[model samples]
Target chain A: MRIFETPLYPYERSPDQDAAAPARHPVVVVGAGPAGLAAAVDLARRDIPVVLLDENDRVSYGSRAICFAKRALEILDRLGCGDEITGDGVTWSRGRVFFRDRRIYEFDLLAEEGHRRPAFINLQQYRLEELLVRRLRDLQSEGRPVELRGGSRVTKVEPAADSVLLTVETPEGPYRLEAEWVVACDGAGSTVRRELGLEFVGQVFEDNFLIADVTMKADFPTERWFWFDPPFNRGQSALLHKQPEGLWRIDLQLGPDVDREEEQRPENVVPRLRQMLGDDVEFELEWISVYTFQCARIDRFRHGRVLFAGDAAHQVSPFGARGANSGIQDVDNLVWKLERVLRGRSPDSLLDSYDAERVPAADENILNSTRSTDFISPKSETSRLFRDAVLNLAETQPMARPLVNSGRLSLPHVVLDSPLQSPDADGLPGRTRPGSPAVDAPVDDGWLLARLGDRFQLLAVGIDVPDDEPGLEVVGLPARRHPLLDERYLGGAPGALYLLRPDQHVAARFTDYDPERIAAALRRASAQETDDS
Target chain B: MTRLRTEPNIPDGDGFYEELLELHQGRSKEESDSINARLILLLANHIGDREVLREAMKAAADTGL
Candidate 1:
């Protein structure tokens, strides 16, 4: 069955619709896209009751936001659907850049060994949403308090003294609901954001790219192929990527002033595809869309009890596949903090760190996305001259190859200056330093990341962890067990202690076991101590 | 820190100028500009010193001012 045509979550009348007063929920998430679905799944896993609302009952129509990076896959693993999604997608680590039909350079994203997931997986965005919906179903069958209200459109959002009021419209009627915490994961055009009168702030590029997803039976290697000024589409760029189920995504850059409606017509699009793919090739167009580059985001992600995440919080040009990937990272960074605040384990002020950490991450994503867009579509003649010069020299010169920016594929933004991280007392590898996400290594029987998510973990290499400490799980590894673990974590130090946050980011590290320091860092990480002094 | 060597670094200065002009020979104005840009990039990469590049840029911009 075509999943896109099927209604995965049909609308059903809920008891809250008939209640006399607005029913209150601990957490209410709007929009069932990648970010919203992920946020709901995370809260349910932590046993925090959450309600997810979406205007549509089925997956999104087109294949939007296709590439899932390794860090996002790792987060999905914590959500319990990583392996399934990874197996069902096309995994690729190599990409080739070309100029006028001549291949110039190729790159391997994951050159090192001992990594579990590939650098990226190309799957239709609909498949990702379906998998998350299935995961939500699995959690529900296990008696988790999670409700998915499809066809329930959030119309109004009003902030109160301690709670947020939401008006949801459904086929049955409109209902009023109150939520202690509201997470808006709606897409670029977010109704929740509009109701609250919040607007995004950034630059918007004046260029349109026509994306055509075609299905054909051909032998093409699963790799990204990017071209600058190809013969088929002269004076502009083109990109080709392999997707699962015999689908190929092709993006052709159409300059600033073009009729968007006329360009997407099948008659107009078929000729463009025929010129590029040749007349002998048998293909069928699956989806066609014309998207403009926009690298804009909200100034802040959090607004009192109403918090915004995903595209509702930020939007970037689709150059580096940073849109949905960073959205999932936003969910990963937020769920744990919300859980702690709800359980009285952390103060509400702890939620403020979400703004501090994620805003910087969003800005970094925007900066990278904007730079990539500029390289791909040079606005002026001098810019194009320099871009072409670099591409020309890149054919034989290695130095010029690094200057060729074909979307510096998405990487996890390290939270370097987070208030949660305790100052490092012991020198170690910078890759696994404080404020960086935990790097995975081989443990005794499985991977190290397998044992370190959803809660605070203390990883001790050749050190005895105090077992009596509450709220901290300890995983002890013998000395020199794995060379990667030694190089990445120990870094010439015989033994060390590391504290990991619930999201698997490094919080603190020490050469010797110090309970007081660990306790203070934990307090700081949870926002229990507002002041460092 | 490396300084921009304004003194005679190339032993055959006239020969170097002749060769550089030959590099842009028979090229249009656009092509010559592109060749100059590429040559600058290559030389800047060979120097591999940002301080020297910055000083050279400042000196080049100060020409005829």
Candidate 2:
């Protein structure tokens, strides 16, 4: 029996590089969307050759999904663009839910403490694409070239045993390019997913929602304003959010039966706005569009040499701002794994966990977005009654405030069982448990895990393991001078040590801190070779 | 709240609630849309406020925003 089977090929291919042809990249990314561009950036930063392709002539226009979670901000920080994006984007700290003209509920996103980053930043998607493009160009100028091919449409993808052959149709003509790996980031209706015969299953909401980007001169607060009921607009609702520019994004809910063309007429929207705000407030319409929400995911994110990221892998409703953020996170999870495999630091099986970990994250986001949609647009009488009761209870009961505020739901750090987290015999509790978002933790200069560089870290909280632990390097998190040190780590539970991935996600947690057990778990998490094996 | 429709002698209240909860959780497109339409109508009737209804309709129109 063959223990190691070669990657299955879709067609036969030559092994030798053509002497007359221009140089080919190690990785060829199709679609210059957030996911594809991010992957290219990650690879380029690691001195890897990458070629990014997109069919569009220009960056994505108008406002697409613009919200970024704190986790995604950290990824951008790793790429050296986090501060620039965060500095320019709008930070929303509060939200309000209105029932007609009356305020039903309000939320303060800043209520949580100890966050290194803000809860979210709203910036135009185009600006992000522009930033990626500029960064890619700068990297190319610095000698680590990342070839960006725009107006180049991928007409065919033929996966060989060792490489992927792509036939692209440019303005000049059709051309073929070969690479060791391919990533497809071409929106929800991904051609690559179809070509590979992957299943994308989910529900598409039937209601048509009209979004109008306009400059509004009104006295409404800068926070997110959601109206469950607005006077003069029975059976309809509206969302008003401030954008980075001196503009507001106004989303008006439309029934499924309404005609899109008639509803888009400026005459209809302007009058409705005049009624909501006084008649004298002037506004300029920048763009108007109708979008239908959908929740979907491809059955499999990887197929042979090709992988799907972003909307290609899954799509979520815009309610929770999960679409763009989740896609960016997908690339974050994939890029390091791909680099390790390419550099021979890890086996190809490391790529398998990408599907296992990210697919669940995608599913969770989809489910959350779907639940939000249902709550906002309840179908059954029972659901409506329940929602109303919850709202009413929230108004009187101060304790229930957090449950009503859904904005707090963001992606949690993944706690996988990996070799990076094996602890030593002298157990330290807080050190071994998976690390969560330290948004509220007090900053201490000497805290080992806190001060560890923004990369993968092995924290030996209590055990004095020599700096080596097989495939992992252990660093002792020194006991703090603070009185709370014992209470925080060893007091409540078994003092355990933890291994954290570069993305600040916990890979493994060990209670006993035993060297042998720690090593075994670490090897398993990283998929490294074990002595027993 | 005004009751639009009620079934008499519905067997196993917990089981029935569980099924609806599952359907809601699953969030099938057809199921959600029908539910949304019914909710809008029910709320509109309950409030008996044309202005509020109109605002909801307008909000629904601005889906992409």
Candidate 3:
């Protein structure tokens, strides 16, 4: 059953209809959703040259950001639209946790078996912006240098002192642009962060989520259930999930002075979807919103030459779906350092290490979305008597179920002290140390993140690498005895030597085989000689 | 029971007591006693001021036992 009542994609106003000779772009990209079409399909697979603006040309009607994790589907399978969005998403790994309605435990974000990807996938933010606009129209019909437009609108942003000037405003008229970098995957009220006013600090959770998205057909169980206070809707918190074709995406929790247009009527969402999907099943509603829970960000997602990715550089509290999966992992860490500082191969203070590694990954996604919105809206009464004595000792204690935070879900953001990582050299195992991430297993039958694509390699599991340099790519694993690759790349060692990054992360890992510590961790992961190894 | 200035209002108090000892670092002592009973019920629900939370739980049980 197809339902995507959100369509609008038509452009060609000859580069801002010949914006009276403003031209000076190397990348402009502002809000084309899903972190500006996954940073214009990872900078047109590095043939760089983007423009991508968007004020409205549809593609975001509802079912907004439906859990995409798995490192944002391996940065959308390295921006080539991961197998057409894992064949239009729906994968799952359980997730139940209820309290006011029993069933207290069931998780399996739990994955194993030589990974390839599948820790999440619910698909729909208008099908992840129509599969990143069909991979930016297949990199604009292979003539690369993306250009996407769509009713373009930006009404100002100047940030100069080197370059960044824009004015746009189209549907036929007004224009003037320039860039040498200016990305703000505009969302979360970011008209280029309000045309460069900036200062977006944090916290706002006062509670008030509605979020509907129905279509129903019962026989549930696609997982992720979460309840808290639910006797078929009473004292707050609900959330359910399924999305993909015959949809389902609940979300209740309407407190803190509601009446915002009578709980977004459909007669207040059909008696709370007939007291939580039951009462002779059969549903309808397809999109709704009430929202209210901000966890702000942007103290710095790089300024000068402007750069900020996804929900305009940080915003959370969509419990663990970490708002567009941390804005598509902030366009996979600012499109490989804005393609090595736009091909000058690094320098431009390597964009201050993408605001020194994404302001501690946006303060760890605004402190896990403000501790899952204070453990699902427990603003007082001693945080709901310690979140109901830790969900009544998590129903029967499995050691209080990882302190039950229904949304401590999204992971992957471990730049363990990153200045582009290079320390770890001792006997391995802090689970792929050196600003972590880059673990997926199974090799020689494919998968170790499909040969760590998106380049910048040096891998080596049972060890023996360091040979393909000239833009280094080397991989050599042989000595395999998989078990999640000797526990995520040899910890009880037989050999190891990672180095990675081109957005796979882990820029350092050695147990032996030190070609000068993998050339000083590939020159401290491409910012070049930072005095360390 | 309202004498609660909550001694040392955080702010780098030795890096917030080394991230509150890295939040019971790597838990497990019954998950660090259910993470100190869910971090003293999330700091008694952020000190929702019940007589300043029974005077900071009787000065944290009479100054650390």
Question: What is each candidate's DockQ, to 2 decimals?
Answer: 0.70, 0.03, 0.11
Q: Tens digit of lDDT per residue, candidate 3, span A464-520?
A: 664855567877776555677777777677888787888888888777775766776
Model 3: CAPRI class:
incorrect
lDDT (Cα, tens digit) per residue for candidate 1, span A55-100: 9999988859899998999999999999989998998888899899
1 or 2, which is superior by lDDT?
Answer: 1
Better of 2 and 3 by TM-score: 2
Q: Write the per-residue lDDT of candidate 2 for residues A116-167, one digit (tens) a residue.
A: 5577888777777767777777788888857777767788888888888887
| Residue A6 CA displacement from its true place in model 3, Å | 26
By the TM-score metric, which is better: model 1 or model 2?
1
lDDT of 1 at A427: 74
* Cα-based lDDT at residue A355, candidate 2: 80
Can you list the residue pairs that collide in candidate 1? none
TM-score per prediction, in order, is 0.97, 0.78, 0.33
Model 1 chain A worst lDDT window (10 residues): A108-117
For model 2 chain A, give the 10-residue run with minimal summed lDDT.
A1-10
What are the interface RMSDs of all the models? 0.7, 8.9, 8.2
Which fraction of the native contacts appears in each prediction? 0.50, 0.00, 0.28
DockQ, model 3, C-alpha based: 0.11
Candidate 1 interface RMSD to the true structure: 0.7
Ranking of models by DockQ: 1, 3, 2
